[model samples]
Target: MDDGQPLFRWSWVVSNWDNDSPNSIVNLLQAHIVMSAVPVIVGLLVSLPLGLLCVRWRWLYQPVSGLMNAVYALPSLALFMILLAVTGAEPVTVIIPLTFYAMAVLIPAVVDGLASVPEHVRQSAVAMGFTPLRRLVQVELPIAVPVVLAGMRVVAVSSISLVSVGALIGQGGLGNFFTDAYQRDFYTPAIAGIVLIVLLALVADGALVLLQRLLTPWMRARRSA
Candidate 1:
């Protein structure tokens, strides 16, 4: 403990809460939320079109998947340093790398979700005289919701946790706690950060589950039958 304080103290968290400073608990948490959320939203949006293309043209899947895998393999810290030079924006430095990471997860999720549709499901849509676009919107995608939500749950939790890594460059949000713990030799902030992060991940995952339920009511109906 720094200054003879205990290893973990709620007082440290309480005193720092929303103190209106850069390092305050509330500020770091809010920064953490934005830093985490923007990438997932952007990644999902980009993956939808890309995944649809990959599914539509079978040959495209290999090249696209390979590229995403390569991108995924790149170290997050290394990318942070590299992107730092390319832009003057501080948050972008973190957001850009995290966006790519989310895509690496979400693209495959989108593809797998689409692929999960049964062959009979497709035939039924066609038999109903559904156009390609209408079929995708009304028939195929609704059925694919569960699988896609599963992937989203994974991405959301991981993304929330990963935001802490951004602290190395000073954009880490709650991740700054780890660095602070190291520098000050105080464990309180670091412990609090971890607890808060887990809670945030749980909340995000639960929200996704609720969304999945709302989107796929028939899943329950099928289970009962």
Candidate 2:
């Protein structure tokens, strides 16, 4: 048995894969996915309406947008700490800060997307008896979908990476693997976690690219036609 301890052992991780403990790698992954998705979905819901409002009201463009820009500039860890203090290490603590992070990234993209809508197209929509809401819903939003999706892609990638910070507060994820590995000097699992996070980011990015292509086929057809 090699002195009753494994030399070059893979079983430490492999054997524990089916464990039901909160700290299990599978549990970590589930927690990470759940935590990250909460913020991205909530942020999108909150930001989309505000984004639409900003486009409709010129006054909101400066103050509200500027405030979100300020939030974006705050470091992720700092925001996390602030939320932790307020919410006391609960899941809501992490979710709230992450939502802010998502919003910070998303709101600007939404603004840019709306602003990028061609002036002529907007005018045409108005002349075609389209109400402002109808014009925004039908013309502006469809054209802006690519940019909005791009923002979501950015947030998804950032959230995956930022989740590592959540490990500091006893949260689970590949981040926990990272922290445990660092503490116990286990190099392989640490490297594995890093690789997994990177791969997740790449996969999310690729999926968003495919989605954009699928959603904007008219843009492709026009270029070819």
Candidate 3:
């Protein structure tokens, strides 16, 4: 369906940047970064305690995991539509739903990470008279960082991708390009948006991997062994 239209024109992408509107590519990119980051941060905070509770009880995990799965399964578009009434089409509406999505992944990661701590380690901490709270914060969570960050890597990428869907309600960040391109029968914005989104995901994932290694230099040594 060429329709005598050039599929991609570099000038169009440049023009999108040059455009002074709030919907300019630069503005959307900034919004995209902020919108994608806030949810993951909030979700991680929320998951830590919930994950701890599940680990402590064991019985609660199945039900709590099920509930989170249900929340994750809700279509983002539909959730955005529903949230629009309460948040009124703001970035929060997108962040709120993505937070649940992040938790759906992070909670399980947290549980599994905590569980991965060798029984001997916990016993040694107890033998050292480390209080439960102190052991958890100083000993357990540090060891759990790699696993939890693994989950966070996934959440970050997924959140970045999902934020594009917010364009449906006008808060989609770079996602606006997709909608705008379709409406205007143009291609440059859509292509640029995709490339940028992918690059952002890669950068974010790489940063998390670096953070993991930095936080657990011993693990890196073990891997070399």
Candidate 4:
């Protein structure tokens, strides 16, 4: 209640959070999750291959990597606007720019991770007649998993915040709550939506940390020791 009434009126929001149905916060959240997941998955898929290519071809590394770095420097809102013009205020518009953004961050991280693999390990694998495919899967990837996961964690958390901007285009999410609340002059709901986004980000970050610990037991053991 801002000045005397209930601040957020949980009951009201709970009842009216959906796009189709009356009380569909569930749908709102689902839309956000789907929107966020698409770009993350697509970006990772695209970046991993490019990262590998960067690792394989030393000459092209500087220029290709520089391009990704430049893309990373582009403002998210600007990218969104450019996409909006082409895709025209649809979910695709949001996802395309977000995918590019994710790639900008992920490709560099993946390349760095792959580079961090010990030179001795690569030499040993090559000497053993391991095919490049086998070497990558059996030797290089395992060592790079922790670093890649760390980069993904950063992207996942960042995407949650960035995805909220989709609400500006009528795409649903906690962003809808925020946009609607502000338009309707309802501070409580707006605050509730912002709080929910923050909480969601924290939860996602915590889950990634847990996953890192699970996946990199050797690192955990060393740290504990």
lDDT of each: 0.88, 0.81, 0.94, 0.79
The per-candidate count of clashes, in order, stands at 2, 0, 1, 4
| Cα-based lDDT at residue 166, candidate 1 | 83
Model 2: which residue pairs collide? none
Error of 1 at 119 (Å): 1.2
- The stretch of ten residues in a row with the least summed lDDT in candidate 2 is 1-10
- For each candidate, what TM-score against the reference? 0.95, 0.89, 0.96, 0.89
- Tens-digit per-residue lDDT, 26-136, candidate 2: 777777777777888899999999888887787988898788778878877777787777888766777787898899888878988998899999899999999988888
| lDDT digits (tens) for residues 83-104 of candidate 1 | 8789643777888888888888
Off by over 4 Å in 1: 2-4
Clashing pairs in 3: 167-172
Return the lDDT, model 2, position 144: 91
Stretches of candidate 4 above 4 Å error? Answer: 17-23
Best by lDDT: 3
Clashing pairs in 1: 166-172, 167-172
Q: Write the per-residue lDDT of candidate 3 for residues 137-172, one digit (tens) a residue.
A: 999999899899999999999999999999999999
lDDT of 4: 0.79
lDDT of 1: 0.88
Ranked candidates, highest TM-score first: 3, 1, 4, 2
Distance from true position, residue 117, model 4, in Å? 0.9
